[model samples]
Target: MTDALAIATDLMPVLARHAAAADAGAAFPHDSVRALREAGLFGLLVPAEYGGMDGDLADLVDVAAVLAGGCLSTAMIWAMHCQQVDAVVRHAGERLRSDLLPRIAQEGYYLASVTTEPSKGGHLLTASSALLPEDDDLLVRRDAPIVTGGEHADGFLITMRAGPDAAPSDVSLVHLHRDQVEAQVVRDWNAMGMRGTRSVGMTLSGVAASHQVIGQPGGFRAIAVDSMIPAGHLAWSACWLGTARGALDAVVALIRSRHVPSSMSRDSELLRQRLARARIDIELAGGYLALVRDEVLRRRHSGQPLDDRSLQIRIDTVKVACSELTFSAVDRLVQLGGAMIGYQRDAAVPLERHFRDLRSASLNYSNDRLVGAIGTMTLLDGAGRLP
Candidate 1:
């Protein structure tokens, strides 16, 4: 096995053991995070100069999928954290990079994304709150309706309007340490799935140092389009794929343990068919993911702008396809498991948790809207062609 894959396989059992308790109690997987920290997974995106693994998209896909197979919440948290790292590496000022990168690499500090505001109505690109200049510092006082991992992160990448009078679309990204920001849990996190994410709404207000702003004014749009969207889409797709795999693995184990003799029953035949279908769906989605991964990395390395509207449309397609296919695979697994899949407390089968988690996949920023976005891009960009 490849070294990265081997590392992921070694960590899966540990993460799987804690997945049940974490889901049941809606608790963060502290142990899982610690394990990942020790494994250098937290530094998977940081450059080697900062003592990180210097890993690429393919590495990220494999690692994220492996972790998601064991625990979706942990995998998601990890993915978002990596996104934050990507932002800092790509755009942060030299002083901030020198100060924070090593800490992230050596200290394993998680960085959270704080961009979704209540007033934005699910549009993460716009920020209602503005960054007010206070003497030498920037004051960012705004209520983020949803800040995933806000309560647990060591720092945050906050988005805000360029100024109090700036348009909502004129947004910028800022880095703030935990001490600089006060995040109150305004909305309780009692979600149907991904409960372990503890993705609660927060009233966030912070003062960032002059050097903390990652890029130029109104630069968040470029970063979001180029780096954040691609990385997040790939990582999320990997996680969903892993979640489906985990569910399938559970069903396969159950089938093996059943020990049915001689001739196979009708139920067994149907189960086999479903299993084959699910596997095929996963493989197809994975093929697309690989294509997207290579294309994105090549574009990035070649200094080609990923700002093309068609490229974004293609990304949306990849994301929606992967998420839907993964959900389909998991649903088939649940059907194959019969009544036993509903037993939430059954330690032998964690299909309920996987089901709950995968249900949130399509709900992430609404797949329907994303498909509509692709259509809009295709129409407006001449012949509605996609990259």
Candidate 2:
């Protein structure tokens, strides 16, 4: 925790410098991103073979929470970077894994989620992007609606669906170099919160694909079901927990700096109850994430299946629990913070961006839907007609 705190504290000045500009400019966190790269924070999950921390899930959560405490948008961007790294570790070629990962660890390359679409939306689904076969190469055309750090990422783990027209081409993950692929921003993203993340809509045209994939194309069912979504959900638990911590930090600072309003901050019992409840919820949320993450580590090392019915259940539970708790914490912090919280330009107000970035959780994993499926899978002894 102290190491995570120290790393976060060192990054605060840099993060603060860009937090407002990014929010106001509706631009990417380029400066803070560069600092993250220089700090070697991007390789937190890269395997030790590639000079990465090969950091456990716990470490990932800690770092995410720390940064989310400072700026949720930046933290999510970093989380996306870790997600990209995770894909390679789970599925990329030996050449890519060997050559690219080391540079990611040492030099710090940018990683982004080139997923998320409105029409054939497959934020985590492989059966959504449109793919066209052209001779030996496949032409992948993707229209992502909310791709985080789309313009800034050095590379993207883009998802494309095999359209009904193409040969039964396999659906899988492909790496897109910024220079090689045509990533044109289709829409401006001026979301009220998490604006700094630059989660813009993008269209990928005429992107050529190589043989290196994140599992066999048609075999993406395994990658998404068994690996990608679950890993992403677990990683987000850490990120939202960080947002909760950051929100709490914001309230504390506000209390210290502002004159407490007598209506709520001073002598109101209801307000006090709400604040107390928020505190309990955030702590409980954090604990849930920590416990599940520890379980993940234990299972990973021991080569044992999770005690939970499917690995997805625990992942879903943690995501739902933390996402709800963090959002509540942010709201309560603003309540306790009064009008000052609404002033986005102020450096001290943490609620604005935290509010926006935390929203990505449910959309990415959707624990509510996962729970029903988990119940059927566990009690019925088989995954049912739910998907």
lDDT of 2 by residue, 83-171 (tens): 67877777777876886799899989887776566764543554466666777767777777878888877777776665445332345
> Candidate 1, clashing residue pairs?
378-384
Q: How far does residue 102 in candidate 2 sit from its true spot (Å)? A: 1.9
Q: Judged by lDDT, which candidate is best?
A: 1
- Predicted structure 1: lDDT: 0.83
Model 1 Cα lDDT, one tens digit per residue, 118-162: 777667678888999999999988787766777889998988998
For each candidate, how many residue pairs have backbone atoms clashing (under 3 Å)?
Answer: 1, 3
Per-candidate TM-scores read 0.94, 0.86
